[model samples]
Target: MMQKKAVDSVMEKIIAQDLEHKELESNFWTMSNHKWALLAWASAELDQSAALVHLDWHWDGINDFREPESRGELSALASLDELREMIADRDRPVDYASFIAPAILFGLIDEVHFYCLQDDTTPGLSSDLLDETRAKEYRHHNIDDLLRTTAKLSKPILFDLDIDLFNRATPFYLDGPEYHERIRSFLGKCSDLIQRAAVVTIAKSPSNYWIKNEGHYDWDEELAGELFNEIVPIVR
Candidate 1:
């Protein structure tokens, strides 16, 4: 149900010319060959959505965004061409949180997972990226990797982070033990509705937050302000 809103507009513009599908679809948004930059935009949008859903995040702003998404609503909202266009353009300025991603998924990853994914023999592995970048991408690229571990996330949490008992907002940055306590505290006391709502919000957010952003409802800003609020009235 992802309408052609973000990518559709740009797609109309680009498709007018005799552009070939495969030409722009050379996985241009990989770790290298970042020619279009739409990958960044797509990543930003996915990151923003992921951060907001799983880790209680929101966007600061974005810079020059070009192109549109080929389709709509992906696992990471990636692989589309127009989205790659919007991100790569120099005119746009997008910024995001740096620290929170690690907290969301530090423990879940390890050397074995890295090596396994790196193995070219593995089926469905993307052979595009160099073994070096794929091995230690966390060192350079800022991809959140929250959903990177698995398609269905056999082990979603890095350390069983939860959002239930968190009846109140907490700091984005935490030291060590305090982080685990907060997540445990929140999930412990959260109601079923709260838990289900939270998951739905997290899943649909990267792709559907714009439904609220588009002025479809009056409380987009209000609801956005208190992400962990767990109050159904505002968003409903």
Candidate 2:
């Protein structure tokens, strides 16, 4: 685990928006912050035409607001303001579930390689709302296929990892040693291609209505810390 000061310093580089230290310590902080931090970090660090490798249990590719029609052609060089406008809805500015859709629509990501538990043909992988080009840029893979394929990615990569990818069960019920090994091995394979990375460790909360885990409301700060430690050195 990083010392508080070290973690704060790293976060300072990644978070382009204002966020209080107290909020970082809170388990109930907005999930959008986590997603945006990764986007901000990648925007600042990577070259053009970077690829986003999203590893999660759920496909976060939903175009919830359908901003593409009005936004027109979104350039990869889009400003943060433009990106913000593309994601905004009347009730909320950016939703965790739908943030990736805006990222794709805004051309922040040239290509998306999604690794999930489900097959490529699953309903969650459907890109019915996206235009043809955007839909073609998306490729799906099974989570466990990382080890089987020797495919190499030429473009710089932004790794978007959600902790829930490890298991559907509550964090309390997770197999700690096995999860650590899996994370370590998977990251080891992809580290060479990664330019930056973002990790989301969400604790089930009422505000996040999508998460159905009915366990305790406590955040898995320890697991987050462990994953952060494992990731930071490789990306840095």
Candidate 3:
């Protein structure tokens, strides 16, 4: 876990449009920020044309730092190190709020389909990268609908989950009991998807929706642990 100051400094690097922080390894990752999942995806030898199934509280479809003239460069960045270098070289940052579009442009994923637990149905922010890439976004509030739709798709599935989805009412509302129930319900109902996913990436999104404790962000770590324990066996 990064100190509050370290987290803040990294957040500052991410442009306001793609608000977040950074890295983790492995096929199943639980990082402080969702943006780092970008690198995790690149680390794997996933299908070049995989379809992303994003289950989160927010539609993280913003492309904060898109270099249109650098399209060839972006597509050429096939390795995790190359992607990290490209991100470091950019003046603006690639963050949770806006990494999806670039993932598509980079040939990492073909399209992104969303299932937002919160009522945040706003479309992804428009940008030059999204315009030319195969990425398209939408909201699927119903689990059955989301499952049925994905079942028909021929593309490989990359399941991306954000912990914030379990506690959707953040800043505005907080219900401890309801939060636990939401987590249980999702895990119970989505076992099939968990088992089916070609790759699973989870975001611990502490700064975005978690509560602050005596000296640290709360729930993110605990929930991440719980998720790993539950998901590892299923995926394995």
Candidate 4:
């Protein structure tokens, strides 16, 4: 496992909004950050029409890393040392890790469709799943539902805007220098995504959608957000 400065790790998860979403959720300090073999999810074969996006973010110590607030009660800020102490307690290891990790499930996303954003259907794959599940297996999903599903997780779709920051700090929340590295890896994984595309499973009932990948990683999520804010879609 690649070790990082505890401060950077905390900042990474904070920027990515990768922390626990609920007060009664699991613990996170002893959690293990996942690695994706440094693969790229997008490839040169990507359709031209695909919108180029940019993402950037910084720490607020408030709002729980949620979207920017114009005016309201701000959340409390967490110091690097304090976050570390809470996470280091051995008794809370499992709870801590699960608290801020990518919740794993065997559930299915039915009626999921796909829509090639480009003019031509690029025969490529996606690594979103791979980043979460190390296996290279892919299942065919509903292209139409995947594309046309305007609603994201029972919430209204957000469009006509740039830069989306979720509740958790994702890899996208890292800084410029590190963000470049992430893009390189994501770009390199495009080939794998293309291959996995054919095998991805898509269910049609109830139209299930699994969002959020593994997180609370050691990488600085704030920097990542600043770097790749454009690539991630806003799930409002």
TM-scores of all candidate predictions against the true structure:
0.21, 0.56, 0.70, 0.19
Distance from true location, Cα of 178 in model 1, Å: 4.1
Query: What clash count goes with each model?
Result: 20, 0, 1, 71
Sorted by TM-score (best first), the order is 3, 2, 1, 4
Against the correct fold, how does model 2 do in TM-score? 0.56
Model 1 lDDT tens row, 92-171: 33212121222122221221111111112332212232232231222211123433432333322111111211212324
Compose the digit string of candidate 4's lDDT tens values, residues 1-236. 54578878866654343222211111111111111100010111222212111111211101121234411111221343433333333342212112111111111111112221222232222344324433222122322333333323231111111122221243344544565465445434333332333111111011011112234334343433442333321110
Give the per-residue lDDT digits (tens) of candidate 2, residues 22-43: 1242121223233443345334
Q: In candidate 3, how many clashes are counted?
A: 1
lDDT (0-100) at residue 87 of candidate 3? 50
Error of 1 at 224 (Å): 24
Worst 10 residues of 1 by lDDT: 110-119
Best to worst by lDDT, what's the order?
3, 2, 1, 4
- Best model number under lDDT: 3
Positional deviation of residue 206's Cα in model 3 after best superposition, in angstroms:
2.1
Worst window of 10 by summed lDDT in candidate 4: 34-43
Q: Put down candidate 3 lDDT per residue, 1-236, tens digits, no spaces.
A: 88999989876754442323332324665555677677767777775577788987678877654555555666566566777765554354566677787777667787777877444445654645556764665567676778777877776678887766655344313355555556566666777776677677877565533533223344455655565455434433
How well does model 1 score by local distance difference test? 0.26
